[model samples]
Target: MAGPLPDGDQAPVDGLLSLEEIKGSEARTFHAYVHIPFCKDICGYCDFNTYTATQLGSLKQSDYAASLISEIRFSAQALEQSKLLPRKFSTVFFGGGTPSLLPAADLIEILSSLEQTFGFTENAEITTEANPDTVTFEKFAALRQAGFNRVSIGMQSGVQSVLDTLERSHNPENVFKAFEIVKGLGFGTSLDLIFGAPGESLEQWRESLEAAIALEPDHLSAYSLIVEPGTKLARQIKSGELAEPDEDLQAEKYELTEQLLSAAGYTWYEISNWSKSESLQSDHNLAYWMGQDWWGYGPGAHSHLGSVRWWNQKHPLSYSKKLEDKISPAVGRELLSIDTAKLERVMLESRTSKGMSISDLEQLEAGAKSRIPQLIADGLIDGQLAIKGRLVLTLRGRLLADAVVRELTD
Candidate 1:
């Protein structure tokens, strides 16, 4: 079993917000992140808050979705009464173990609830995450009719062997078919990929990138594989059933990815994300990297408004039960200190195409200014951009993005 809950994580029925502070909220965009934690098949490497059919025993999809919408209404009513329910949702994102697995009617019902409760922006960028195998022209068509304008499909790899090792259950061909279907239906699309799996080669990664580019997706997210503790993949590596990814090899692949994607006319906006154009960037995610606010609904979901952040109970049944009782289900929360918030800004802003101001970094720490010249001299950042009052990462710096953050924060 997992260890005892951490401090400030003892969840209560009315802990979502202090209620006293809701009227004073200055959050600009109320982005919605509805987490769907059910998956038909759980991937071996995944450590996300998700469960498969057997693990979910008696939880019905419809019931789960209904519980989510309940929280939506609950939060919306509170915000509305406080005159804080700004103009509809700026963006509504359905992310998860496989948001595609939810029945179309259930998805529409949930999304519609968000619209009815918070009101969707006139041009709200509604997006859903999907595994290629669960995608269908009919499903996407229905989604389009329901006001979803974007689909981020998982195209983890074009190589069969890599997919097999990762326990991913879709064909490379399925990725192409799904992309074509979403694009044909006029939905903006993004593809998700993972690199540095055990035994993966630079050549294989190159082919994977090549395959993804051929699809001409509006956005691409390539993440370095992480072997999270307590996961099957981590256990396998620990027990010698699988080889751990080589750090040096992973670095080389990151560099090559930068080269290939840049040549493909995709701008590396975030360390792992690339977009075809500024208009197609994931606005919901931009809210995150920039420290904007959003409200997450569902078991194990997280929410942030200004400096205060909170997450929900992790069990679906418990989450459902709490809403049935009409109580705030937030398990834990923290109010960020000014210093902590600035440090977070430096950490997140350093990884983006929108670079940070040197002055801002110095505000976090005076010594940060002294490190700038040395960082520039080390070629981690462009001297040109630095002179213009920004700290944009060089291709090398991006590969070492964490190091840059540490140096700045230190």
Candidate 2:
């Protein structure tokens, strides 16, 4: 289970957007995110909106696809009624508790509904996040046939002990097999790694990184483990049954990650993501960082269009009931003020390789502009890039990214 949803203005039942809220949407890239909130077993460290079979009393997993399709059609009607121009989706991403838990046919059906409603752009990127154990060769093949071009496998750790500590359900060996299946089907493959587990060692982290690299994945994301409040992992640490992650050790591991991945020919495009080349970057994720419009369908999913952002009901049952009644599942929404939107743009873009423009910062706050020279002097930003009008982070800056954002925003 996740934390409570943020407070905001109540969303309209018809799901209609104001013309002012959607103005200029035609000029922005559009995307779709389908959230699958089912999981075979909830991981101890996860705080995402997810539910196991036991937790969902009356919600049948078999009926989930149909519910999502209803939302898709409803979204189209809402946008049309709002008088927003129809735009093809440039990317579609299926993320969840474990998207691979659903039957491939269900995924295909939901995707077909999306295509039938708004269509897709030429060369559109479609991706899904899969747990290694839940996927098979036939599954990947079927998805490929249905037009999914990318797959991100959850390969949290190569070491059995680390996986055990995280309470991951997949066998370590299954990751390589899943990767082989997806790659053989001509899908762009990505592997996810997590470091800084409660008891993880530098050597164990190295082994995980090496294992992912050996597969020669097109893209990789290395994330530090965060034990959110109310999660099982957090409880264990609170009870002193498990040691908390050491920030110093995590910093050391990050530096090791940069060193090894760079040596293996991967370039960091964002603070936590790397790719073999620019073409292999995760465009769907980049859309979020770049502030493009995307409609998120499914329980607990969040969507952003122009200046407005909204999230659906968190529980699957609550989400489905609203759709069944021909209402938007969105419980609340917020219209971002100009200052809020600009600050967000700075906060997100500053973490990417295509760093924030210096002029934009100056416009946001003159003090932010003054902080640039101090940032460069402290080895937190690339001096040459600053001279060239962008605030690109140095390696050290990436490790202290939140601090960098504070300096600029303050």
Candidate 3:
């Protein structure tokens, strides 16, 4: 199960974003993240805040678009109340419980709401997450007309048995079919592949990567599977019906990923994320890793600006009721302290190809900074980049990213 929602009232408005944070001298990249909390099927390995259409009692799809737009309007009003000028959104991403499950018109209506309230950057990237089985070329065309330039397809595996084990319904061929359609329609396409699935072999993982690379997607995100507590997959493992994922095996697979993708000319911009080039990297996700501002809309969405981070109410019914009652649906928030912020910058930036600056590393305890030389000696941190004044990671470093973060922060 997902962890308990934080306990607190909606945070104070003044705590949302300071006038300075909102109107900084330097223009910050702004992003909009729209979450669609409904999916047609719930995969066994999953634990996201989502529901199927039938499970969503009283939350009519007909009323969903308007209610979502209303929330966007409320957000804009709040910014106005704080006397901050809203810039054009740098990127807009419609993530889901299967965003493609909604009609094309619904996606457009949400995009239109953003345009009316915040405008879009002239070269803004607009993307929607689509399950390979749920999208069509005609729908792609409608989405293009509605100004979406990218579609990220979930292609969990190329092996049928792997899909079955994960309880994913889409045929592997459907992934290539969706990719071809998106490319044919002149849209930027990204494929998300998961590795380290229970019962998955190293060879199966390689085949899945090769199949995805064969399609020549603009971007690729290879993530290791995490079995969340209370998920069907976790229970299966607990009951001995499924094998637990092997950590050492996953580390080997991660190295294999760097080799294969880098060989194909994909730049590893961030751990777990690669692109044909920097231009093809996900701008919306970069905004997050780079610690910029973004407002996430819809149930269970999270938003952040400067030090304040907050999330919306998790359930769609509760989310809708709050919006209908003209209230902020934010369930809780926390203000990041300066020390915590510095640590976060190091943690996020160090995982990227750009890495963190040398002087910035000096911000940590001397004992932590001293470990860099040893890290480089162990083939973890890149010695070349360290000499050039940045903390770029080696392929080995990425596999042990959590350990690196712990050494540097704790």
What total of clashing residue pairs does each candidate reach? 1, 0, 1
Q: Write the per-residue lDDT of candidate 1 for residues 216-240, one digit (tens) a residue.
A: 9999999999898888899999999
Backbone clash pairs for candidate 2 read none
Q: What's the true lDDT of residue 323 in model 2?
A: 94
lDDT of 2 by residue, 1-410 (tens): 25778899999999999989997687899999999999999999999999999999988999999999999999999999999989999999999989999999999999999998999999999999999998898988999999999999999999999999999998779998899999999999999999999999999999999999999999999999988999999999999999999999999999999999999999999999999999999999999999999999998899999789999999999999999999999999999998898879888999999898889779876778788888899999999999999889999999999999988877
> Please, what are the lDDT tens digits per residue for candidate 3 over residues 77-183?
88777776766899999997889988888889899989999999888999999999888988989999889999999998989999999888898889988899999
Top-scoring candidate (TM-score): 2
Q: Which candidate order results from sorting by TM-score in descending order?
A: 2, 3, 1
Least accurate 10 contiguous residues by lDDT in model 2: 1-10
lDDT of 2 at 322: 99
Off by over 4 Å in 1: 1-12, 15-27, 81-85
Weakest lDDT window of 10 consecutive positions for candidate 3: 8-17
Give the local distance difference test score of model 2: 0.94
